[model samples]
Target chain A: MDLTFTPDEQAFRDEVRTWLSENAPSEPLPSGDTADGFALHLEWERKLFDARWSVVSWPREYGGREATLMEWLIFEEEYWLAGAPNRVTQNGIFLLAPTVFEFGTAEQQDRILPRMAAAEELWCQGWSEPDAGSDLAAIKSRAERDDDAGGWRIYGQKTWTTRGAFCDKLFGLFRTDPDAERHRGMTYLLVDLDAEGVTVRGVDRLDGDEGFAEVFFDGAFVPDADVLGGVNQGWSVAMSTTGSERGLTLRSPGRFMATAHRLVDLHRRCREEAAPDLRDAVARAWIQAEAYRWYTFATVTRMVDGHQPGAESSLNKIFWSELDVDMHRTALDLLGSGAELDEGAEGATDAGLWMKGYQFALSGPIYAGTNEIQRNIAAERVLGLPRK
Target chain B: MRFAFDDDQIDLRDAVRGLLADTCPPETVRTAWSNSTGRSDAAWGALADMGVVSMALPVDAGGLGLGALDWVLVLEETGRVALPEPVVETAVVGAPLLHALGCDVPAPPASIATLLDSGASLYADTAECLVVLDGDALRMVDPSTARLTAEVSVDRSRRLFAVEMAAGAGTVVATGPQARDAVAAARDRGALAAAAQLIGLAERMLATTVEYVSVRHQFGKPVGAQQALKHKLADVAVAIEFARPLVYRAAWSLDAGDPDSAVHVSMAKSQASDAAELAARHALQCHGAIGYSYECDLHLFMKRAWCLARSWGDARSHRDRVAAAVVDA
Candidate 1:
């Protein structure tokens, strides 16, 4: 039960810290929701790829350092501490790339992983639909074989597609067999956004950012080579993506730790005028963040020891998503009425970063399977409660 | 870095859990509730024979020099059964405190209660020695030297006593900065031990409630099948799972002697207290009428959780410490 980093880990941490200190952006990049902002983020990804800092845990052939899980965690910590921009390629690199590595053919891996790592072809998730959000198995999106054209034709609407508008590609679950059961009929497909009959309409989030969109597929054709894993086995293949989304890849504890430290700094600056309740809230946020950090450490240890995470990922999702919301809420409380001010408004702090973050945090519980669904999973699978 | 117990620690946990499963079940705890001292000599002797009483004492002091992390699982198992023993106070905190203060007293299998400025002490009457904290110094007083007034705790299994120490009584084991550090270490480790116990208690309470809800029928179905009750219990399970890593991390920090160990300890204690409190509320409510009765075993753990939640350091006090470190820097 040791918490101290080994000398090798410390050395790796130093290397990461040095590189981030030198190469990290001096100011926040534009919002990735915007075209210009997307380009800027792509440039940043190129910088990381050039330095082999984009995906440290992946093998070198896939443009990574093949770093250990501990080293990957150290990289994340340094990445957040340096105030680096959020990974613009996370959807491709973290979510889809792992599935590709696991189930993609060698040709697919060779062609897709490097581009995904370099952020040359950005990706978005296509799981939830207008009809199927929490009840993902109810997806009615259909894909029929186009034997002459050599693949399948997809037709459905996928709503709440994060990065849908800007991303060049998507990996989604399409019902391949209309006669099969709910989970059995689905086939995971990789589709080009520029394909004929694919229309993406950006939806304005609460913060007025078009970070996600509603994607409509009208007879979009996809090749058979784009199918991930076996047809009708998409449920298991997609389950891997959901696992990564909730557990390791999508949200790292370092991001929350950095936010926690920022909140502490904000509290320290505002301590003179901060209310007692706000003080307690700030402290609670810090404690929760620290808990999350240690929890992730234990998780990484388990994963490194060859144990795959199970339903506990649901627990992690519920905790960190709620913690993110509460932490931002505390920040707003410390900011008082000024929290409502815009970026350059008089008396605004951190350019209203907390306000933007609070809005985003609210979406966390809704996405990656809603908290209600996660709780049900935790209840039934983790606790062995009887399913109704 | 490994964030798990080694083979030996795992063995110790299994051994203690097995012993408690046989010797100090809820039935034994309920039986001891009516006893004057609320002490079970048989269970204590069995645990002592397992070396838990001297598990944390230094080797030169005729005991294993095991650290808090090694004995944490043992303390957790004690909470699992609501064992009528001061193992946390005596072995987890007291023995280490004495050894740090250079006390050469034999590591007796009997419990040793600790007296802080907080007034109440655990097993004060049953313990052979009472390690009292006086400002920055520690005084190891013979329990017979202090005037003991028994007080009924919410948890009947825990026999609380208010002690009035005699003037110039006991031996001043250490003073000044060294005493201060030792006292601080004791408080942090004590709080951590209490945290682990609370986690274990919450886990047992949740499991017991889940088992009951599965069998107890209402409105033509088992109560566990109801969404409302299921969700409540699910939240309890999540809270317990989340608090676990915090407890383990706190134990690790204490063992590693991290500079921020105090803050980590406070966080662990605060989270564990909240988790246990949540479990107790939902467990009792889910069990309905039977959970409220003294005849039911659920009340034993519920009451134990309530007692331990306020012991070592309450949530409010620990939160203040967290605020000092995090908010105030």
Candidate 2:
């Protein structure tokens, strides 16, 4: 197997490297929780959209470069290496957009994709509910046909909706047939967040940020045109989103590699006081990151050759989630007493980025399907183990 | 960049796997432990007939002259069955070392073997020639010339010998800069081979444990149906899958002659070792009392994994090398 990039791929990387060096964000944008911060992130998305760098792998008609999978990976590496701001529109662009491309009608694609690319209609997922965290098929959210037979009326409460407070729309799963089987009755619907009878309450995360929210829909109207795939077939469509969440779309190896490099620098800076165990931990973090990078390369190659990722995505989810937590934990251990400092504290190192990241990393295993559930999926689907 | 094996490599892997499955089954491995030499001549002859012994030797030396990456899958297959042979030492390390040294050392038809450090060498009693890296020099000595004291290893299938070579007993194959490069390359290859083998060992152990748990009943049901055992096996599966890419990447780095090949090799070795150790612990726990016994086939792979985990370099030693590369850079 060849590890060196083709000359054309190298040229593409150089092009991306040059462009990022000249035009990447100079300062960090505000967190996309508050209205002001959301506006700032939307502007950043606009800038990327104008440069056709918002979604490089998407078709050109959807405001992307229609780049190859390898090129998309290269772009991610360059973007993270350049210290680019996090994509606030990821819930729509990375998660929902792929499903839409796979299952949405042409009209839906024409009406929804461009706005998502520009972050004009930011989106959040509505899959998880208070009562249906891991047992997703047990969701009690219901959607019934309106009296006029024009659309559906949705009534449900979706919790852990990341960026829900800032999002303009949501792609939610609602049971359309009450008497049908657990997975057969669900319908995937697109609902406007500002529509009548919709309310969002922010949930304060460990870092004291409203990064997610609980969205309440009280008879919210969604036209028949907003339904994705087909009625009562949402389970299969939503599986696409879960696949994207576990696959390369949600967490790119470049982010971990960049963090790993930073950890190495920290280890070097504190080499004198760092314990032997801490040194090994730092080295292990880098090695795991490198392994992840190579694994992603193999995955992207398979995808480029027109094969879909299967149970391996479950393996990827478990691996990256654990790696993220371990890497952050190691960094905190290296920080010692300084780890307790928040970003607002005076003379905080790295503005307490590691502490903040540790908080976020804690959510990795919990969100995008819990690691326990992912492990079950891997065991049952990948290892051919019997389910209880 | 492609990070997968080519068709020829895939065929090579399948062929090696088939041969091992047919000739080097666990029963054969167990029986070999009682043999005087503790080496399975049948399996060795099969591998030799397949030209695996000379796969890494230079073309000028009447060999295939394949690179390290090409031999990775074969080494992994050998590890899967815990093949009681010095293929890793002879084919992967010694032959490459002799080829690079351009010395008139005994070739593959006459088995060659090598060792990592000075502690013990594998198959030194059976090999015609033993290649050892002494400081910056690569030395070749007749096994009969050295004091070969048989030592028992944790894995019974492997027969280890402590070699005490007298001064000037070995012919210096290469010295100075050439010797240093050859020694470094051999170390990297050795580490990579060990790492690949560990992955295979983990994979086999995990698969065997999964199969055992599927049929073993507990609390009126199969234990594999329980979340605890399933999760443990899943964790082992995750570790094995992730460690594989690192081994492949390290092999690629070595073949490419990259400057950072040493770091990649160390990382692969460390990761593979950790994965194999985890697999061994969990495999035994899941298999219960039977896996701990020699009668059960699971102990064969589990013990081999334990021995291989500390063979080329233990996890800590490899991590220390990595620390030197990244932390001390």
Candidate 3:
């Protein structure tokens, strides 16, 4: 049950730590300074690339260290702990890289994996459509077979696409057969964002940051080789994709650890007298965030043991998503009247990170699949309970 | 890294469960509740003999060297039976903290200790030893040494004591910065274990309600079949399930031994408090007027659930802790 890395893993951690210490940007990597922090984060990714530290888990043939999952977690924890800005290439390196490694052909891997690791391409998730947040199989986006050009023409709208507006490519799901069941006839596609008939429009989130966007395809062309898995097997591919999202990138412990540290620091700076209720709430927040840390550790252990996350990822998803919201809510409660301050407002405590976190946290349960949906998945699939 | 209990730990769980089944049955709890004793020493002794009391103690301390995670397994069983013993207070809360602080108390079997909150610690009650925190310092002292009055608390499952201690002999188990860290760790671990027990108690309470409603007929049908009662019970089930991971993850984190152990433990405790109270309330409501009867065991676990949940850092405190650690800038 020990969370400590094995000695070899520890050494690997030491090596990576030394490298990050040497190369990590001394300045806070640009986030708010840039119109899109995603672009700024790419610079950090390039730093990781130059150091050969990017995508630690991918095979060396495709620019990865082929490190173990534990080492990967160590790298991530240290990356955030070092005050590096969010890794912009996460969607590409963590999600797409792994999926392509597993389900992508040799040719597909050769084409996508290196570019993703090198930050040559930026990727955005295209799973959730307007009608499909929880029930992803209800995705109505279509990808009809274009036998003439040996490719598929995709036509669909994907919302909640984080960084979609600036993404160089789209890894998403589309229904290939209009007459098939919800889960069937879907295909996973990798489409060039600049291709004809494609449009990416920014959407205003509660944080007022254009972090998310809507990617609409009137008739997007995708080579048949761009099919992540087999035609009509998109559901499984999409499941694996979303699963990777939930299980890997979204479940990154560093994000929460940084947030958790920021939370404690916030309380220290913001609280005048440390109201009792706020104190207790802060403690619970730390406890859950800590729980998430270990929960992720446990998940990584399972993966290390050659087992993939299934219903257990549901547990992780629920814990992390809800904790994210609860943490911010507590911060807001602690701040009381002070929470009314808008971003960049004068004398704003924590520089309105709490406000932004509050807004971001609102999406925690909604995105990646709602907490309700995760709970139902756990009850029905994990517990084998009768679906109500 | 493995979450499953090893073979011996599994056997320990099964054995404690068997003892609980044989000795602390629902009927036994009912009788004990009706009596002024609230618990049976004979059953507690059986637990002590089975080494359940010393399950979490270090092996070098003449007890099983099971980790905090292992104790959670026993806690679940203890919760399942709704045993009226001080497993949380003595084993989970008191002894481990004391032992960790180098207190050479006999390794369990009968370590009768109660958790004393800051308010209670200041008021010195009838407890022999009290767990107390003064600012960032935690002191374990014999309350009999200090004269203070015990205040009436909301829950009465275990004796709540108010103890007075002059900031000394607790051997700096942890102090200054480490003091809060140590207290937070113990509090979180205790809360997580207690919450797991509460989950077991909640499950039993909900089950009792379901069984009672199913068999007790009203308006020419079983009360359980009624949507009103069914929905209430369903909600209870959902709360229990929802809180399950918070407890499991908390305990798992503590057992897994992470730095954020304190935070995770609080979530479990906080979530358990909400879930257990809701389940108890709904279970009592579902039982109707009969659930209030002295002959029923529902109130025993219910009273214990409410009592344990509020003690050792209540839901509000835990929630605050979580927020502080999670939402800061």
TM-score of 1: 0.97
Q: Which stretches of candidate 1 lie over 4 Å from their true place?
A: A344-346, B135-137
Q: Which has the higher TM-score value, candidate number 2 or candidate number 3?
A: 2
By how many angstroms RMSD does model 1 differ from the true structure? Answer: 1.5
Writing each residue's lDDT as its tens digit, candidate 3 over A290-316 gives 556655666666676788777656656
Listed models, DockQ each: 0.74, 0.86, 0.20
Please write out the lDDT profile of model 1 over residues B171-269, one tens digit for every residue: 899888988888878888789888989998999999999899988988888888887887798789778877888888877777787888888889999
- Top lDDT model: 2
lDDT (Cα, tens digit) per residue for candidate 1, span A1-388: 6778999999999999999999999998877777788889889999999999999999999899999988888899889989999887998988998899999999999989988887788899999998898999999998999999999999999998887999999999999999998889899999999999899999977777788899999999999999999788999999999999888778888899999989999998888998998888888888888888888888888887899999889988998999999999889988888889865566679877788889889998988998888888888888777786
The candidate with the higher TM-score, 1 or 2, is 2
TM-score for each of the candidates: 0.97, 0.98, 0.77
lDDT of 3 at A342: 64
lDDT string, candidate 3, B1-329, tens digits = 34334677678788888888888887776665445445655677898777777777788887787777677778988988878666776777677777777777576634444444445531134235666666566666565665455455433434444544554744344557666665656666667777888888888887777677767887777776565665466557656655775676666667767777787777788878888999999989989888988667777788888877886778887776666566443
Interface RMSD values, listed in order for every candidate: 1.2, 0.8, 5.7
Task: Indicate whether candidate 2 or candidate 3 has the larger DockQ.
Answer: 2
Enumerate residue pairs that collide in model 1: none
Model 3 chain B worst lDDT window (10 residues): B118-127
Q: On a 0 to 100 scale, what is the lDDT of residue A321 in model 3?
A: 76
Output the lDDT of residue A47, model 2.
Answer: 87
Error of 3 at B217 (Å): 14
**Candidate number 2, chain A TM-score:** 0.98
